[model samples]
Target: MDHEKVNILLVDDQPAKLLAYEVILKDLGENLVIASSGREALEVLLKTEIAVILVDVCMPELDGFELAAMIREHPRFQKTAMIFISAIQVSDIDRLRGYEMGAVDYVPVPVVPEVLRAKIKVFAELYRKTRELERLNQELEDRVRARTAELENSTAKLRESEQRRSMAIAAGKMGSWDWDWITGDWMWDEGQYRILGVSPESFEVNPANVQALLHPDDVDQLRKAIAEFNSGTRSYETEFRIVRPDGEVRWCVGTAAATVDHSSRVVRVSGVTVDITERKRAEEQQNLLAREVDHRAKNALALAQSIVRLTRADEVKAYVNAVEGRINALARVHTILSLSSWQGAELSKLIDEELAPYSPSGQIRLAGPEVQLLPTTAQTLALALHELFTNSAKYGALSTRSGRLMIGWQVDDELLTLTWEETGGPLVRTPKSRGFGTRSLLASVESQLGGQAKFDWRAEGLLCRLEVPLTRKPAATAPSKFDAAAAAELQRASG
Candidate 1:
């Protein structure tokens, strides 16, 4: 609705006619431009934003129709309003032609100043209104684009927020629920369904169905917690077991707050449930480990006491050495079991520890497959091996640099058979009387460990064979001919 004066171009073949048209439009308060020919009018239009172009119908080469056709061909001027001014009266056909060529109206020659000014005024006003409508449309389009962009940005932010919320819920292993206690209506989130090991499509959601998933023993606990809430408790927490569809039981911890009526009747409950199965399992394992540690401690102390009571020595130094040596053997086995989390100790490692102090490298050769012995078996075997190693160092193969001792073991039919052979040592002879080392070794292998031990005092050196059950059970203690043949084969293999 701008009231600013718009440009009006007046074209004629004669300068006088152009001036006349200009004089007619001058009173309309518009900026009137004069062009003496059609070409001159096009030149004016190229340089100016003409609201109305008044062209001479008959001109030298490019007339009104030609100029209008050329102007309409240009994209910028396609909608421009044009009017044709003619000196002679034109035919209806010529007028139709002028209208088709983009002319808005026609002005006759020898025009009435009033008529010419009125026509120019109407067309110029129309041009101004059309420009205003185009400007308004452009502004509306800009606003729509800006609003669309803002809405897209807001939608993107909402989607991102939802993704982060879902991730947080999953990471915490938690799910939320809302229950209408009055109507028995319930709503569970995705996490709730997942924790219960059911899907919305597969499971009916109701109080009875949900209760069916609970462990029978824990159902009373859950009901008691709810009863407490109904009796004016603001909130309650409970842990229970869930029997999943796959027959696996899982632990869940839930905390809920209830809204009650004026009479303290429960109206609604809302809460979150978390999967605590792994945490509960870790706690159970820790308790079992504690109990096992206590048992092992008591047994080790009792065994140490027995060793101190049974150990005998004529001299105080010898008694101290014997007791210390036996206790040291127990301590070494204890350390190995502790390192393995009280599971077992490696057989090869246990033998190495017992003989490392007495046997030099290459003089003592140990040949055995890797074997893991139970804690009790490891402790017993460590004591027996310590006794044998001590006796050998004092009087047998380990006492001389040229002596060689070979220890080997094999597992067959769940029984471990080990052999110890000595060579290149002083001549051997049977003991006149049994020493504490020999007696302790025999008792440890035969009675406490439920195994058998055989000693052969050969002319060259002592050869010993021990048989123990891997199951930690007592095996037959009677000697067999197969044992004699195995011992002879071992001696031949050593030579």
Candidate 2:
């Protein structure tokens, strides 16, 4: 809004262009300084705290490119970016020369007012923001110094006050422990003894004492968090468990942050602790409660969906008909697996089941991870797998016998992934609209199984990838999905 603003520098040899820019930017409230010649611009910058510079390349005595090179020679102005504005069409070679001369960008003559305003506005706003941030950072550093000085002046007095008056308070609140970071010696205030239900006279305060009282299961996590603190890796917030001599276990949470010296070595760390036994108990039961809620909600959804399918059996509306179509589609998946007595059905069996019903020739084939699934899981995978097979048969690579199909499965850790590939088919393109079949496939396989389904339609062929969790209990050719023996059999197979 004022001539003394620091965010922008506007330069143009033509009086008309400079006047036009001033008019356009008048209401912008951004810094604006005009230069009729490159020499005039360089003279203005000798004293101004110029955040940016715009130089016209077609000036009379010295062009924008020459002026930029001169500015680059000055260390103070090395990063003061220059934008070249000129009427003459700049070639690649000319642009390269401009860049070499420290020109940050080039804008042609007869620039659109809106585009110019937007561009300049962005650079001006960024310059002002950068100035504001630098001021804030300086203020923050000053405040931190003042605070640190106060802490240094009062540490001894504060320590004495805590030792005299805080023994009982800490015992009721949390155990008090302090460590000499340099010497690795530790001291536990009398409150520590009460927190652990130990007699102070019988206990020797050391890091080992702290470890001995912690529950074995929580030791590793606490140790890691503390390790990060010691190494100055990050601020410390750690949770642990303590079991007293009376065999009563309680949860505890500790926080610590290291203060570093000038050379960056940690000089000291201090923080507080809180007894969190009740909080930990709630956390332990959270998963069970969540699962119960999810099970009930899912059962309700399935019932509603099933009812809708039955109720809309005779409806002709496209969307209502979609519900009925999904039910029949799921039934088809069941039919294929049922044919095999629910034993691990062949991948080819699934492909043929879905595509054979639509295409004249069942040119389906299978490859990779020749394995069977639990019957329940089978219906889910088969339905999704079938959708891909059907899509290929009609609108994908599987439409022609010349098109090939590749199907495979793999298991690693507890994850099972299936891949489907089709080659020698039609060109790949995105779908215009997703159909009921797509919805059913996604719902049956991914939504129900808590897994992911990915589709990649490459020019070469269509690729489908499905990943699900597999049990470690071994792979089985067992009869029913719900049978424990079946899970055991699969575990054995996996091994």
Candidate 3:
């Protein structure tokens, strides 16, 4: 049988090294993923399943050994193969440490392409075989279970009374029941009693007793199904809920058939009941996830719409640039939130990413404690920061080579206070009137986030302060009608 391809991850800070590995592994016909740093490798591992990981031994932040240890810590990747690539001669102690950290093998510097390819191919094939074996084992187990069930059913049909009852005990979650209309008699096997959460000694096998165990809402449904069966229906299937003796409500599916005499009149009914509570719970969880995705998608579209409708510029190019910049900021926050499973995003990371374009100049500094912001808060704050950065780049501190910007924040009593101060720039003067950029920044913090924003036009540059509540409830997915009205008023004021 042909096996499906597996994934192989290559980690190195050097782009050249990653390219060389890619070239060597191309013939393996496996999915090859490259990460330029340990953090990037972790991110890839979060979203992809890898059979083999080839990591450089001397990368900064997180080396091969550290990465191996972290990967091994996760239950899903515990058995994944890790190979360390070292440029220099590794000491015996270093090799030992690597092995302890879950490294399966080591390739020295100036690797032979053929040797590297061979090693990766072996591991990739092994991973595929292992997965195939697991699948086959599961199939064999399923077939065995099906065969056993068939044999037990056949035995139940061939035998009567005591022998049939013995077979029902071995059917696990399934239980057998029989009812005779002529004698008004009902029979339940040991498994039936177990399913009802009762004992034969305490509970009698009678119609009224069984009806009492059925959930109130499902009683009418079961009655309707019985009525249909009595009207010449040979076999019928139905799902219902039963409230056990211990007050636990369990979902069950029953398959039943009618037995008739020569006159074509129903004489008896027999059926099997199986617990289906776990399946129902799983379906509920899936529905919840789908709703969450829908909610997030609507929120994203609404934010995009607001950006387009509210943005103002004099020239067409300037308008497109402004809209694209705001949209990109929204996209960046979305990426950050997705990486975290949409739970939230770190405040420091959001700021760093928004200001990354000017980071290389070494004039921007960020100081703050680790703070996580909700998705709505992060999205609005990202747009506000983008506007601030754009204005600074065009005419503020960032417009000059000698200028410096400091971003600092502190949290106290469930509130975060952040300050953005600029120095060493051209002389600053307060604007004669509010523009769209200023209005947008204020609206993002005040209207959308329910936060506070204060700006002071100092002689040196702009100094802004922001205060946000950390314990606020999540905002609505789309902006409210009031937000639109406010946007219109702001636009008129700016004009």
Best by TM-score: 3
Ranking by lDDT: 3, 1, 2
Models ranked on TM-score: 3, 1, 2
Across 1-495, the per-residue lDDT of candidate 1 in tens digits comes to: 348889988877888877777777777888988888777777888899998888888888888899999999989899888878888889999999999999988878778899878888888889888889989999999999999999999999999988876875776468999999888889998899998989999898997898899988898977887778767888989888999989899999999999888987889999999888899999999999898777788778766866786677999999999999999999999999999988889999999889877747799998989888888888878988888888888899888898899999999887889898998888899976667677667766776667789999997989999998888642212223223333343344345
lDDT agreement with native, every candidate: 0.83, 0.68, 0.87
Candidate 1 worst ten-residue window by lDDT? 474-483
Clashing pairs in 2: 397-425, 473-491, 474-490, 474-491, 474-492, 475-490, 475-491, 476-490
The model with the greater TM-score, 1 or 2, is 1
Q: Which residue segments of model 2 deviate by more than 4 Å?
A: 1-7, 156-495
The TM-score between candidate 1 and the true structure equals: 0.58
lDDT of 3 by residue, 199-286 (tens): 9899988879889999999999778877897788888998999999899998889998889999989889998988778889998988
Of the candidates numbered 1 and 3, which has the greater lDDT value?
3
Tens-digit per-residue lDDT, 70-94, candidate 2: 9899998897767788788999999
Decide which is better by TM-score, 1 or 3.
3
Cα deviation in Å at residue 357, candidate 1? 1.4
Which residue pairs clash within candidate 1?
none
Measured by lDDT, the strongest candidate is 3
